[model samples]
Target: MSVQPMLKVERLTKTYAAAHGPLTVLKEVSFALAAGESLAIVGPSGSGKTTLLGLCAGLDQPSTGEVVLAGESLGRLGEDDRARVRNRHVGFVFQNFQLVPTLTALENVLVPLELRGEGGAAAEKDAGELLNRVGLGERFDHYPVQLSGGEQQRVALARAFINRPKILFCDEPTGNLDGDTAAAMANLIFGLNRERGTTLVLVTHDLALAGRCQRMLKLRSGAAIDGEPETLAGAARGR
Candidate 1:
């Protein structure tokens, strides 16, 4: 039998009230992500990629439709309850490394555990292991400012994975990195998903990175299009 999807979006739509009238950013968008599957979303600057990510993650409410995460309907939950659910089941990585400057790398990773009321020796041990997995074991005590852009991003990745979330959402994760560093980061992301069986939903414009995912969806004018999987597959075969 087929396993249930970890995330389900049904007729999802988002609209905002503009000066003139209602502006729709997403219209009847729907998709499903099975456990441990990785999917990439690609679109131009104003195509609503970020907006869709936010809605999927329960960080924002949709103007219509429902988002079911791990079998729970996000649209029906209140803000505090939604936040609780996210903490329990979701992890997020942003385009900008959102590490706190004052916290050490290890401390940054540990923050999530603390927020979840998971602390002490076990939390420290797990945080250390996650940082090590991201190739930052030696830089554990370094503050965010003390690290390079790539290093900081690694730290952010570590933090995101600290909870061993069932689903991870990444928005333009490698956007600010150089080509080589971005490639390295992409490898690390895929490696982590493979090892941990974490479902990944990523928004990116990098064709190389998007091609590595199991599937790709392109957004245009607030609607998602089923992209040609062969486009990425051909690129892989050529390489």
Candidate 2:
């Protein structure tokens, strides 16, 4: 028998209230990803890539259709239950790094464990190891303000993985970095993802970064195209 996909989205759609009535951001977007697979969503500024990611990650509800993550139907859950599901299986990295400015790197990495009311010695040890793995071993006590953008993003990476999440969602993960820094961050992300066997779904405008994923989904004006251009496909294949 075929294995069930780690994530499934069926006929997903999202709409927002606008002055002229409802503005639909995503329409009938559907896809599936197996465990440990990596997929990238690429699109222009208004193509609804972020919106689609949010819907898939259960951060937002679709106006219609369904999102089933790890065999759990998110569409049927209330906000609290959805949040619980996310906490249990999802990790998120954002463009802004999203670290608590006042918290030390180690502290930030420990937030997820603390949320689950886990603050035992084992949790602390794991948090420290994740930071060290992300090349922030010596920066564990540094606050976000004391770190560079790349460093802060690294801290975010460490934090995201601290919970041992099954799926990771990243939004414009390298948007704020310079080219070299972005490349390095991408390498680290892919490396750690492989190490942990985490399913990765990311929204990015950077074709080079998006190309690194196993599969690419293109969006235009809020609709998914059948396939990407030869150049994009070639880039992905080359990677």
Candidate 3:
């Protein structure tokens, strides 16, 4: 028998009310990803890539269609139910490195576990090991303000993996970092992702970054176009 997809979205759409009329940001987008597989969404700024990601992650509801994530039908859930499903199965990394400024790196990493009322020696130990694995063992006590941009992102990476999430969603994960720092962060993200066997759904405008995923979904003016990334076409032309 074929395995069920870890995430599946069918005819997903999102619309917002504008002064003129209804503005549709996404229209009938669809895709499915298996467990432990990685997929990239690439699009220009106004193409609604972030909106699609949010819908898929259960952070927001779609105006139409369905999102089945981790075997839970998000469209049928209330806000609390969706949040519960997300907490149990999903992790996120954002461009801004959404760490708590006042909390130490270790505390930040433990937030996910704490939300589930799971804490103590074992949880702390797991958080510590994730920090160490992300090369932030020595900086566990440091606050986000004390760390560089790349360091903060590293802390975010550790935090994302703390709950041993089934899936990870990255939104412009390296957008704020320098070139070398971005490359390093990408390596670390993919490394930890593979190590933990987490499904990855990454959204990035950079073709090179999107190319790293096993499959690529391109969006244009809010339309989904599933295919190989343009980078492959460019490579073929260059050769």
Candidate 4:
């Protein structure tokens, strides 16, 4: 039997009501990603890349069409239900390293499980192990303020995977880091993604970073211009 795509969105459009009139952000963008697949959405600012990512992850509603993620149709679900779906199956890494300033790295990583009413020594241990895996084991007790940009992002990465999400959604995950730090973050992301068998959907402006994905979907003027499947190489396969 054929496997179902981990994520599928079709004819998606997001329109906002502006003082001028209706503003359409995405126009009929469609794509599907199989389990264990990776896709990059690359575009210029105001091209609706972040908007589309929010829509795909059930963080925002679309103006028209459907988003079927892991077989759950988002448009049909209530906001609470959508949030549940996100909390259960989706992981996120953002450009700003959205870690809580007051929480230690370990506590931050435990937030997701805690939200699920899950916590204990086992969850704590798992969180610690993930931090170790991401090269932040020693920084567990440190707050976000104490860590460098790259280190903070690493903590975010560990937290994202704490739930063992079926899919990961990254928005400019390397946008803030230096060249070497960006490359290192990319390596960690793809490496952990591969090791955990999680589907990756990345939004980036970096062409070289975009090239790492199995496929590319470029958006221009609020529309998708899908590219042929990429020939994965270089930084894509680690190093």
Quality of model 4 by C-alpha lDDT: 0.91
Better of 1 and 4 by lDDT: 4
In the range 8-57, model 1's lDDT, one tens digit per residue, is 98888899999999999988888888898788888898898999899999
Badly placed stretches (over 4 Å) of model 3 are: 226-239
Q: Lowest summed lDDT over 10 consecutive residues: which window, candidate 2? A: 227-236
Cα RMSD, each candidate: 2.4, 2.1, 3.2, 1.7
Candidate 1 residues lying further than 4 Å off, grouped into runs, are 226-239
Report lDDT (CA) for all predictions: 0.87, 0.88, 0.89, 0.91
Off by over 4 Å in 4: 226-239
- Native-vs-model 3 lDDT? 0.89
lDDT of 3 by residue, 32-146 (tens): 8889878889888999999999999988889999999999999889999998998899999999998999999999999999999999999999999999988888998999989
lDDT of 3 at 39: 82
Specify the highest-lDDT model's number: 4
Candidate 3 weakest lDDT stretch, 10 residues: 230-239
